[model samples]
Target: MVPQLRKLTLMRKIKVDIFRKICTNWPNLTCLHVDFRQEMNYSLMKHIFEKCPRIEKLKLWTTMLIDQRCMELLSSLEHLSTLEVLLDKPHLTPVRLRLLTDACPRLKEIHIDWNYFAPQDFEYFLKANKHTLTSATLLWTVGEAQKTSVVPLLKQCSTSLRKLRLVYFDTPRAMETVAFEALGELHSLHELSMQYLSTYEPKLISRAFRPGCLTQLRRLLMQYTTDLLDETVIAISQGCPNLRELRICASYKITDVALSEIHCLRHLEILELSRCSGLSGTAMAYISQLPTLHTLILQFTEDLAKLQPSLRLIVELKELRCLDILKSGNIKAVPFGEFPNRLLKLRELRVTYESENDFTELQRKMPNLKISNTAWLTEDDFPKDDDADYGYRDG
Candidate 1:
C-alpha cells in the first residue's frame, strides 16, 4: 500500500513550530503563499528562505508593518522568480524595495501594495530596476501625488512591460493628461486593466485616444470609469481592432450607443457587463448582431426582465456557448419561453434567483441548466480570495 502525503498552507497565524515543520519537510515547494498577519515572526521567514531553497514563486500578504528584518530575509531567496507583496500599512522604504529587485536578479513579475510607499520612493524604486520588470500591478490609494509618481515610471518602464494594471486613487482630471501621454508611448503593452477613482468624469475618456496608446492591446478591463459614452466607445472600438476580450463593470455611463460601436470589434469573443444599469433592451438588440461573441456575462442589472423578450432575436448567435446571469433583481418576471427551444452549441448556463417559482420555471425551460440558489456568492468560493491575507479584492 502507498502512503498518503500531507499538505500545509500559511493561514491566520504561523507559529514557529509550524514554520519549522514546513521548512524541514517542504524543501522543494515551488509555490508559497503567506499571510504576515498570522506569521509575522522574523525567525519563521528566515527559516523559509534558508530551508525552502527551491521555492520559485512567493506571494506575501502583510497586515502588519514591514521592517528591515523581513526585507533581509526576502532578499536572500536566490530562486524566487515571481513575487507579489500586499502591505496593509504604507511603510515599504525605498531602500528595502530596491534591495528586493537587486537580490532577486531573475525576477520577472512584481505586484506591490500601491499605498505602501511615497511617490518619490516609488519612482526611485522603479528607476532602479526597470529593465528586469516584465509585468507590474499598482493599487493607488492616495490621489494626484501617486498618479504623478506613477506616470513617469510607466513611461520609463514601458519598454519591457507586457501587462499593466492600475487602480487610480484620484479623480480623472487630476492626472489624465500625463497618464494618458505615458500610455501612448507604451508601444509594447498588450494587456491593460484600469479602475478609475469614484469622482472620475466622462470627458477625460478622450485622453485614451492618443495615437498608439492601445494599438497593441488584446485584452481590456475597465471598472467604475466614465467617458464610455457614444463617441468615446466608437473611438475605442475602432482603435482597438485586435481586442479579443472586453470586460466593463460598474461603468454607468455606457448606453445603447456604446453597443452599436462594438460592431467594429471584429475579433471580440467574450463580453462581460455587470452592474451596468444604463444598458437596456436596445443595447442587447445591438449586441445580438455580433457574430463572433461566444461568451456573455450579464449580472446585477436592475431591468433584466425587460430584456427577456428580446432573447429570441439573438438566438442566431452561432458561436454563443456560455451565458451567466446572477444577482439581477426581479429577473423572475422574465419569460423563459421567449428563448429558442434549441441552443445547439450552448454548453454552460448559470442562473441565480430569489424565488423558487423562478427556479422551477427556468428549469422547465432549460432542463439541463446548472442552477445555484444562493442569496449571494461570497468571497469564500474563490480560492484566491479565501487564501489572501492582506490584499483587497473588490466585490
Candidate 2:
C-alpha cells in the first residue's frame, strides 16, 4: 500500500499471480521498469498501465510482442513521454509506431535496441515527432533500403533532436556521403555517436565536419569507421569548437595531424583513441597541447621507441587526472611509473603491468593515486539487467 512511491522497478522474474497482487499498490508511480523472461502479454501490460495511470517513463526489457490491444492500453497513459524497449525479439513495427504517435500525443524521447524498423517506418516516426522528440537511440541493422530514408528522416528532426546514437549491426557498407552530410543540419545536437559507418571516399565526409554545423556538439564518438581520415577529424575540430569529450576507435587512417587540430577545442577534457595504429608517438605531443585535457586513453603501442617519448610528453598536461594505457604491451617498457610523481593531479592510472612489487612501490610513492590493470573498457551501450535504470529523462 505504498501509494506515495512514484518509481518502481521489478527486474527479477515475478510470477503472474504475484505481480497482479501488488501491481495496484503503486498507483502514483511515474516511472516503471520491468525485466521479465516470460513474454510480456496483454494481461501484464494492462495490469501495469491501468494501475499506474501516472507513469510518464517506462522501460520494458526481455521478450515483448505487444499486439494492437496492448498498444491501445499503453497509449492510455496520457502523461507518457520517455519509452525504452530492449526486447530479445523484433517487435517495433510501423503499425505499432503509428498507433503510439496517433494516440500518445506527449511521447518524445525513445530508445529502441536490437530491433529493425523498415525504411518507411523511420520516415513516419520522424515526421510525427519532428517538433517534440529531443533524444533517440536506435541500435539496429542498416540495409540497402535504409540509405535513402536515413538522411531525410534525420533532417526532419534537425531543429529539435539534441542527442542521436545510430549503431548498425550489419556488414560494413559505404553509406552515401549525403547521409552523413545531413547530420550537420542538426543544429541543436549536443552528442552524436555513430558506429560501423564505412565509406569509400574519405574526402567527401569532411564536408559534414566543417564550421557552422554541429556548433552545439559537446561530445562525439565514432568507432570502426576505418575510412575516417585526418582531414575529416580536422574539420570536426573546426565544426565542434565547444567539444568537451572525443573518442575515436579502430580508425587507422587518422594520424597525429588530426590529433593536432583538436587543440582548437579549448574546453576539451577527455580524449580516447584506441586501435588507431596509424598514430605514431608524435600524436602524444599533439595531445599535450590541450592544456585543459584531464583524461587520456591511448591503446596502441606497436613501436616502443616512438611511444616512450609520447608517454613523456604527457608531463605537459598539468591538469591530467586519469591516464589509461590498456593493451599497449608492457607498462614497464615506458616511463609510466614516473607519471604519478610528475603530475600532481593524477589520481587514476590503468595499464597492463603485472608486477606486484612495481605496483606496491608506486602506491607507496603516491598514496593518493589508484592504479589498475584492466585490459579493456566496455563500450557505452544500453543498460542491461544488472544496471538498474536507463538514466532517461523527460524532454
lDDT: which candidate is best? 2
For all the candidates, what are their Cα RMSDs to the real structure? 4.3, 4.7
Score every model by TM-score. Answer: 0.82, 0.85
| 1-395: candidate 2 lDDT, tens digit per residue | 67789887776777887777666787888998776574478887888788878889988753554565765677788898988776544444433566677767888887775455666656676788888888887643433344343544677644588887765533224545556677677788898876555555667767767799888998887766778889989998888998998888788888888877887888899887878888876777788889899988776655545555675777788899988777776556566566666788988888777676778877888889888877444535222322222212100
lDDT of candidate 1 over 1-395, digit per residue (tens) = 11122223566665678667766776677677776566465776777678777677887765322556876777787777777776555543533456665677777777764435555555655666567667777754322333354655668754677877665345246666566666656767777766543435555555565544677877777655544566666666877877788777777877777778787777888888777777766777777777788877777877686565554455666677876677777665544454436455665666675557755664676766555544344542222223243224332
The C-alpha local distance difference test score for the whole of candidate 1 amounts to 0.63
The best candidate in terms of TM-score? 2
